[model samples]
Target: MGLRYSNKINKIRTFALSLVFIGILIMYIGIFFRQYPIIMVICMILGLLAVIGSTVVYFFIGMLSTKAIPVTCPSCEKPTKVLGRVDACMHCDQPLTMDRSLEGHDFDESYNSKKHSKTKA
Candidate 1:
């Protein structure tokens, strides 16, 4: 397939990592605004919020883990978690689906957009 699909857990992990990096960058920027204590404080708070948000996201992932379907990836021969109706193998990035109807279809991220599905239905 032309489309590349990544594991849902991996995607969330990447998002968490980006949030952390962005938080640090924002906090660093606040250092440059030392002359304006108020702006610096606000920046610091915002940066803290980002980091905290990432923490919450991480927690949410943990909660999702309990609900994820555990399956062995055929391509990677590794155990992975499949979230929702469609997900990819965490180790090998192999597209997987719980729905039989979606089987053999080209992997598309749009499948995850329920609004798109609703409109089509």
Candidate 2:
């Protein structure tokens, strides 16, 4: 775990984009198994399924976007949607918090957890 925490939306987007490439690669590999029609068909179906799964995931992200908190990133001076109690800026990766008590303090993702926050309280 490095100190480079990414924006939640950006992370999910990356995953979805990677999934598309993986699905394509899997489908391409199916061509190599042309001698076995059944196996090739199965591989093709699996690859298609992966692509469909990614579409569902992307849709889920869209649904979640409606629930995210919109705020201006102090560091970037641009509006971004924060997905959780703690999230990084979409533009600059600066840590943002919805908690007033934690403002202007060190950025700790733990503050978003109920157990950790309660223990600190």
Count backbone clashes in candidate 2: 0
Tens-place lDDT per residue, model 2, 1-121, is 5577788888888888888888888899999999999989988998898899899889989898889999999888999999877889998888888877777888777777788678655
lDDT (C-alpha) at residue 18 in model 1: 89
Q: What shift in Å separates residue 114 of candidate 2 from its native position after superposition?
A: 3.8
What's each prediction's TM-score?
Answer: 0.86, 0.87
Residue-level lDDT tens digits of model 1 in 1-121: 5667788888887898889889988999999999999999998999999999899889888898888999999887999998887888888788998777788888776777887467544
TM-score, predicted candidate 2 vs. hidden true structure: 0.87
List ranges where model 2 is wrong by over 4 Å: 117-121
- Per-residue error for 110 in candidate 2, Å, reads 3.6
Question: CA lDDT of 37 in candidate 1?
Answer: 100
